[model samples]
Each structure stands twice: as C-alpha cells, then as structure tokens.
Target: MSRGTSEAFFDVVEWAAEQPWSSGKVGLLGISYYAGSQWRVAARKPRGLSAIVPWEGMSDYYRDRCRHGGILSNSFIKFWWDRQVITNQYGRPGRAARNWGPDTVEGDLSEEELAKNRQDQNIDNAANHFRDDPYYASKEYDMADIEVPLLSVGNWGGILLHLRGNVEGFVNAGSEFKYLRMITGRHDLPFYYSEEVEVQRSFLDAFLKGDDRVGWSVKGKVPPVDLVLRKGDVGFNDAQAEKAYPRRTENEWPIARTKWTNFYLTPDKKLTRLEPLHTPPKKLSYRALGTLEDPSLIQFTTAPFEEETEITGNVVAHLNVSVSADATGPTPSDIDLFVTLRHISPEGKEVFYTGTAGDPVPLTKGWLRVSLRKTNPDHPKHRPYLPWREYLSTDRLPVIPGEVYGVDVEVWPTQVVVEKGGKLVFEVASGDTQGSGIFLHNSPEDRSEEKLRGQNHIVFGPKFSNYVTLPVIPPKYGA
Candidate 1:
C-alpha cells in the first residue's frame, strides 16, 4: 500500500545499492515532503539504507495530519491539497506569494490544463474516514522498524507537522544511534540558520563520510539530545532575528526541575489548585447543535499568577464528562470535545501565538471523541508528555448514554513563559460551535447541523476528576 507520494524512490535506492561502482551504503536526507518520505521508505529496511535525516515532516497520516484528536481537520488539508499541491501540478503555477495570486515567474495557466495535470489526492472527502482505516494506515510507516543511524531534525515551531513525530521517531526507532536535534524558530528558519546548518554538516560528515569522531559516535557519550531554548515571555513566535542569543543544551527530554501542576476545574468555572467543593456532581450544559453566536462553550480560568511560570513539554487535560439522553434529530452517539489552551493578558485580551490565527492563536490545542477515550497499556508511555492513545478498533470503548467517561487529551507540546499577573485559561466545547473554532467539524463526533445531537454535561466533583496536568517550568532565577 503506497502512500500518496512516490514509493518508487526507495526502489532507486535498492537499484543504486546493486550498482557496479556503488558503496552499498546509502543515506537519505531532505526537508518537508522529502523528509516525510524518508521515514516511510526507511521502514521497509531496504538493503544499503544506512541513515536518514527527516527534517520537519509529518510521520503519521492519521493522528498527525488528516485527523486531530479524532476529528477531521478539513481546512488545512483542503488548502494544502488545493493551493500548494494542486497549483504545483505539472502545468499549473508552482508556489506563489498570497498577494501574487498563483502568477509568478511561471506564466498564467489554463484551468483546463491544470485540471488535466492534477492527480486525485483521494482526500477530497477525507471527513468520511475518521479513524485510521486502510487509507491512512497505508500511508503511515512504522518508525519502530527503522534500524539505521538516524538524525531526526525538528524545530520547536513545527507544531503543525513535525514536532511530535520527530520526538517519537528518535524514541521508537530500532536504531542504537538515533539522535534528536531541535532548534527554536519558524518552520523554515532553522533550515538556513548557520548554526543549525553547521550541526547538520557535522552529522552528515560523521555518518556519510565515515567521520565517526564528529557525530554521536565521538567519545560514545555526547548526550543524545540537543535543544535551543526560546527567549522571552510566553508568546510562541518562532521567528527570530539573526542573533537571538542565549542558546543552550540539556542532556535529556524531560528537562530537569519540571514541576507538574494540576489545576482543578471548579463548578463555578475557575481553575484552582485546591480541590473542587465536596458538593454533588455539578454540570454545565449547552445546546447540542448550537450556532457560533449561541452560548455553547464553557471556559475556566486561573487567577493572575504572582510570578512568571515557563511551561514546556506536554500538557494533558483529563476530562470526566457525560452526555444527556436525547432522542432528537440525529441524536449523538458520542461527544466530540475541542480543548484549547490560552493565556490571558493582564489587560484582558487573549494572547495569540505563532501557529493558528495570526492575532493570538491558541498556545496549544487538543481534541477527543468520548467513544475512543481508552489508552493502550502496551504503548510505551512518554509519561507527562504524550498520552498513549489506543487508536485500534478493538480498543475503542463506546460511550453509554448518561454514563460518565474519562477522556485524556494531549495538548500539543509548546514553550511559553507566562509573566507575572498573566493567567492560563481552558476552554471546552462539545463541538466547534463557536467563533473561536480550531478545526472544521465533519467527523462523527461533531454534533453540528443536528448530526450527533446531545447535550454535553461536564461533571466535576470528587469522582469526576476534571483537571489539567501542566508541566510547569519555574524561572531559573539563580542560573
């Protein structure tokens, strides 16, 4: 089952291996789609495949790309398939500036020729396949099968496509010499930065040129991890000046001295460290299929912090909720919830980050369908970072009407420094039935247009442990 891209490239590698004057040892390297394909091809363990450097590309088709938190992400995919992939078709204009309107050094192209040149991406109606069916599964290549020396490159700003996969690849690969190198910057910024390029050169030299003294083989003990800390307050702007100074490195993934803070959600919509009141289970209900302007989302916020708190690594929100019974039109069989992390400025404005919308995109986002809330025990845990989602068909546990179910959602990994007096906020909604929508609703969980109809009841009390486990990194005051 070939993924959407070219699988024949790997065949070329095999052919090159058997050449009359070949070294019989091959290494793959590229950025974006090129980087993405390296993972898929390396999984086959083709003869002579020695190394791979997947710099900022998606490794998983289902969870990482097409669908997020079990909901179909239509907007990004549609635009990607239509604009970049489609325009760059054989006869159409390649990538162009937004204001340029697809007309650049390449001449204007005919709509007909462009149509004839375009190949079916098969993602036109991606919303229909919510789970990892044969379609998405075929596109994914298991990283665990890759046994080559790997230098998985990633950028902290690669929240949309590469961050998680890069980390996962380094952790799961069968290779004994896998290393992870991450820098802080916009998606393409690190690719051209001199320091980042120098690092890449050394890795390539050590592996491809057999210069073992330069790469991980040197001394047999350079911490397998390298990262650049982002500077300043809590905004996630990865773009940086030529000299953003203060670059440093740590030995491992779980940064030292990371204090995990669990904030409990009170019935009164407050985020507090103290436990919720000992009263009976409290509920916040919203119309099952309400419109954007309607009262649909329930938000909880913590009080202004007295000091700055730098949060990095993963943040998990465990929700204990239930859906009220209803036999109305297209009654919902499960609940689809969109969870977003936000920072409130002292003056009362949502602080936007780099990823989503330009103004103040969510610091991070998470999604989940109540029916598939179960976790896999065998899934080697990433601990406080990634919640091992059991996406298997057998592992999915259905939601019973009026039954309380616990769902764990992983907010994308991020780096932010919340200054004193700043507040953290959590917004919850059964569906994207609000102006602050993160993903377009098309999956079975989305109760939009009366599709999966049911009132969402968020229960919070002693038994209903509704809280967010945040990896809080306090300021290095003495350092």
Candidate 2:
C-alpha cells in the first residue's frame, strides 16, 4: 500500500552508498515533498544522512499540516498533495489517476484529471479525520528520536501550515546542531530557485560537504540562527548573496532581546498601551460578521513615529475576548491575527518593507492562527514575549459572550527598522490580508450566515491588563 515510501527511502540510501566519503557525511536536500520524506529516512538514522535541510517541511503532521488547532488545514494540504505527491509520477510522463469527482473510479486518468482526483481524495481524507484522529497521528514522526543536525526554513506568510511547524521543530528538536532561518514571503514561492538559495547552500556545504570556506562563524560561538527579512526587489547578487543573509547567534530559541507587551483592544476601537481599564473586568462585544469563517480582524497602530525604530523579536497579543452564543458554535472559534510595521511617508503613502534597506522593502505583512494565548510557566517573564510553549491541556475552553478570557496570539520573529516618521502598526484580523483575492470562508458545506457570528472582548487594567513589550536596544553612549 505504501510502496512509494519504501522506494523513496532506498533510493536515498543507494545514493548515499555511492558518495565518495572518508567520513560518512551525506546531507538530504529538497523542498516540501523531498524535505518531508527526509524526515522519515532520517528517523531510521541513516548511516550517512548526517544533516538535513528540510525547507518548509514540518515535524508534527497534526499540529502543522493535518489539523490546525483541530480544524483541517484543508486548502493547503489538498493542493500540495495533488501537485507534489499523488500525480507526481516521479520522472515518468504518464498522466495521474483521477478519483476526485463523482464519475471516475477507473483509476486511469489524465494528468489534470488525476490532479483533481488527488485533490478530492486529500480533502475527503481531511474532512473524514476532521477531529484529531488516529490517521492524523499515524502520519506524525516522533521528534525526540531525530538525532541529526537540521536546518529548518520557515516563511512569514505561510500561516496556514509551514510557519509554526518550522518554529516548533527548530525549538523542540533534540539535535545539538539545529539551526532556524526564517524568511518573509509566501511558502511555495521559490527559495531554491532564487538567490536566497545561497544561504541554504552555505549551510549544506559547511555541514555536509565539509567546506571550511562557508563557515558558520559570525564573530561568536552560538547557534547559527538567522531571521531574514525579505525587503523587496533589491536582493543580494550571486557574489554578496550569502554574506547579506541575516544572522543572529543566540543561546536559545525566541532570542532573549524580545520584550512582550500586551496591547488592549477597546470597545471604542482604540488600542491603548495601558493595562486593564478597570478591576471589575469589562467585556466589549462586536457584531460577529456571522460568517464566522473569515471574520474581519482588528488593526492597531502607533501614532506616526519621528525616529527609526528597529523592532526585532517575537510579538504576542493578549485579548480578553468572548463570543456571542447567537454568533458562533460550541466548537472553539479559530481566526488569525497579524502584526505589521509601515512607514507612512510625509506624502502619506505607506511604504512597507519587503526586504532590507539596501533590498526591496515589503509593502505590508502578517503572522497567523496563534491559538495558544497562555504563556509557558517555566519561562514566563512578562518582559520578553516568548510564547514558545504549547498549553495542550486547555483546548476545550469556549469563548462566552460578556465573559473575559485571555487569548494570546504569537507573531513570528522579525527584524525591521522603521525609519523616522514611520508608523509601527499591528493589524489583528480573522483572515489572510496579505493577498487580495476571493475570500475563503472556513467551511463550504455547512454554509451559514448565523453560525459565523461572534464578538471579541478586550480587558485592559493596571494590574491585570494590556500592553506591548518591545525589545529596546539601548543607545550606545560615547561611541
């Protein structure tokens, strides 16, 4: 039934055996499907598979790809499996099998038809195992057993599946030589085909090829972690490409420089820097757009700034929220929140950073679906906002109307230096706002204008309240 998996494993093993090596050091390289497969072979502890470059690959199938906080990440998985796995014939030119629509069970289909069939099968499987079922668990690999060095790549816009997994794997993996590199952009967009591939190649060369030219040293002895901000068009050429990549050597995950500040959302649509407005606990409810699927998110902005501010760290939002019974369902509501930094020019045109200063700047950006609002008790310091720990025990708590529950959303780690007079903004909404297109409601079958409705309440007071903690790099005096 799973001949593909067995065949793929042996193919790599065969290739490894042919490699000329005084020391058994072979690295696995590829994106998505190839990267995903490496995990399976790596788990077996292949003799020569010393390092792995799992670009945009996930360790946990359930949390990362299969189910997004219990809801199926249907759109992403269905499309990927069809394009990359099912119909991928692998060096063959034959058409894929089609089984998606009502008519075909013949198993023999055209490439296009097979693609559609594969998509259908993927979605059907996802829908059937909608709950955190065994099928989902079966696909997941045990992270504790992975013993090789890993170089995980993550994207800021891949909120649906890839982003969280990269972060989680990089942090949780027991590998002593694990490194994380986060780049901003869409998930499927070319990382290998683009100049950014140099960064990846350097890592592979150093770890796998034993090349001392592409050393991981950067003035210090620390974990080689980088958070690359995709500015825009002005990227590094072949010569300076590898050197230009962002590198931040750190002793731990979610770098220590970050400061977590809780910004409270008010009923009047005002984002205040203060704590809870009152001690009695207040709740503000808005009319849920009822199509609870993709509710309108909230955007918070600071008054236009006059100086260049470098915000480089993890961001989390603490919301004391609730849902109107008339609006949503018994199942917990899932939505996405985004944090953006924009430079409002004197002409009032907002210039978003797409890359670095010398590189093209991004127009606008966001992170997504951070369901865990509670902080990990082991490393809870309201000072640096690092929401790395997952609180799996509190999954059943439902949001009640007029009731205040703390909901914290973690924004991916980023490094952006907003110039003088630019505005530092945070937009919290229910859906993806990066690309403008047809809006996708959560569930297509159970289409209901009423079931989608709900309201979010925010509480801000002195002691128990709302604020945003920022990592302020103190000025270098007398430099």
Q: What would you estimate as the lDDT of candidate 2?
A: 0.51
Give lDDT tens digits, candidate 1, residues 1-479: 24545368778888888898877877887877778788888888888887788887767766766667666766566666766666565445544554424454557567887777665553433533544566655676667888888888766555555677777777777787888777654565567778677777777767667876554656457677666554444455535541452555555555676788898888888998877667476788765543444546788999997887777777889888887756555555777777777777777766654542222355666778777787765667636556877465665676766788887887667666676888889888765533233335544333454445777888877678789888787554553
In the predicted model 1, the residue pairs found to clash are: 234-417, 332-453, 352-360
Q: Candidate 1, overall lDDT?
A: 0.68
Q: What TM-score does structure 2 among the candidates reach?
A: 0.70
Residue 132, model 2, lDDT: 36
> How many angstroms is residue 31 displaced in model 1 relative to the true structure, after the best TM-score fit?
2.6
Model 2, 316-418: lDDT tens digits are 5555545545423443353333344333453456553323212333333333333444456565333335453343435334433455555555444445555
Best candidate according to TM-score: 1
Error of 1 at 14 (Å): 3.0
- Ten-residue region with minimum lDDT total, candidate 2: 230-239
Looking at model 2, residue 199 earns an lDDT score of: 68
What's the lDDT for all of these models?
0.68, 0.51
lDDT of 2 at 84: 53
